[model samples]
Target: AEAEAIVRYIKDNPSDNIGVITPFVKQKEYIKKELESNGINNVDCGTVHAFQGDEKDVILFSLALSEHTRPETYAWLKNNRELINVSTSRARQQLYLFTDSNALERLHDPSQEDDLYDLACYVRSAGTYQLTPKPVESRALGIRPYSTATEEAFLENLTHALDNAFSDGSHYTVHKEVPVSQVFMENISSKDYFYRGRFDFVVYRRYQKKEIPVLAVELDGMEHLSDHIVKARDEQKEAICREHGFELIRVDNTYARRYHYIKEILTQYFRS
Candidate 1:
């Protein structure tokens, strides 16, 4: 029933990604099954101690503040502080905290507020942390941005980066608009320095065979970044891609429709 409610919340607000963290693995499994049975997608829960270096945009910290009443209870309270610090750091925009009022009062400390205030100030000071839109500028004909030498250098630089990233055999990938299944080819060779994964393309030319670079190619009638869901999806995809080693490459739809800028980029990837 709770899982159904969570799924309904997600479906109604598609912008949100659900993340659940608790102090028990059994609970995680229970919730996972409940969520799956109810058709909830991407719901994860695990022990608070197990959650580190991971984050969600919105987090529901369920630890009761009132539980830490005794000085000896401070040890248990320490976990809550750690979870709060880690959880708050994970959100890029917002955070949702739930607990009893008694617990909130118990957890409230003037010094803690100062620390949180400092962190919040730092977050706000990040100044959007969003990429500025590429402006449309017309260049004069024959004034090419790519000289043979510079182009080769640029290609080499990109190739080297991709190669280095793909040195790891296992990596994440993000494909924009392009179906996940179509991202990789089956005939990838050991010498090819790239491998096709179950979902996306893997770049393996860099190191030994450790990495797989993420790839993204835009395929909308127009740029889809303007849409919030599209943008969020793109962000989520990019995040997943980064978790592996893939980089995103955006191409105008016309690039493929006309000559083949997409192919050109791929060729350049190989050459680089």
Candidate 2:
């Protein structure tokens, strides 16, 4: 939630004047990778120490952890006044703070007051974004909608680009939520972990009546970062694509925004 929100803000704003400060170096590095993957390398991102003597036009502060994920660390951070003070005061124009709702669900030690809970209330973002997507749950209940806002926008633009590129009777078509194993022509081994893993979209080239699988695309956002399981899944997907002689484009939200950038990428493998 923190990473996606931060990346979206940076992509739309697109300035070196922006800064990101997270409480932990682990989360800070995770977010940095997400930004860099999206081709956003200019922003200064680090823990509070990196911003001690600096300010930015826009500042995003992410708690970047839930009690469930890291209990002792979160317990320590939620009460640290210095952490909150230094992080929030660095923003010149706009300040956005993010934390998971689950993190704030449990009460802090009432014996000693903590400012982070108070801060979460003002932001109303102790995972508010995580719960507020009612339309996603209402509309697509079965198999999607974690970060549907980003995915929806990207798919709309990508679909349009694909249509325009194949204007004279479109030859290739895009499919969403497709299984990774299906991309292969050969039979599957029963023990593979990613056999049931799904790709964001698969593009197939149509020749006569047969639709040949031509390319695969994955939209990676902040969710893809920091999770060891997700990283392992990515490595498996890449390996599968390589072994099967299939073309896979692992795109960041940065690349997904531009219809032209996506179009240019597809044209190399699937020119109409």
- List TM-scores for all candidates, in order: 0.32, 0.49
By summed lDDT, the worst window of 10 consecutive residues in model 1 runs over 136-145
lDDT of 2 by residue, 1-272 (tens): 78988899888887548888888888888899999999998998998778755657677888876656655675677656556655654554566777777666564554544456655654564323221112211211111212344466678787777778765786777788898767776534443745767789988878899878888888864324533445677788777777777788878654545688887877765653
lDDT of 1 by residue, 1-272 (tens): 33344455556766775566543355457666776776766656665655454556565433322454453443344334444444443443454443345543454454432222222223345523332233212111111211233223333443444334443363332322244334444322232222322222233333455444345543331224333434544565555555445565554322222233444675575456
Q: What RMSD does each model have against the real structure?
A: 17.7, 14.1
Mark the regions of model 2 whose C-alpha exceeds 4 Å error after superposition: 1-95, 98-146, 166-170, 187-191, 270-272
- Evaluated with TM-score, which candidate comes out highest? 2
TM-score of candidate 2 versus the correct structure, residues matched by position: 0.49
Cα error, residue 111 of model 2, in Å, equals 18
Q: Give me the overall lDDT of model 2.
A: 0.67
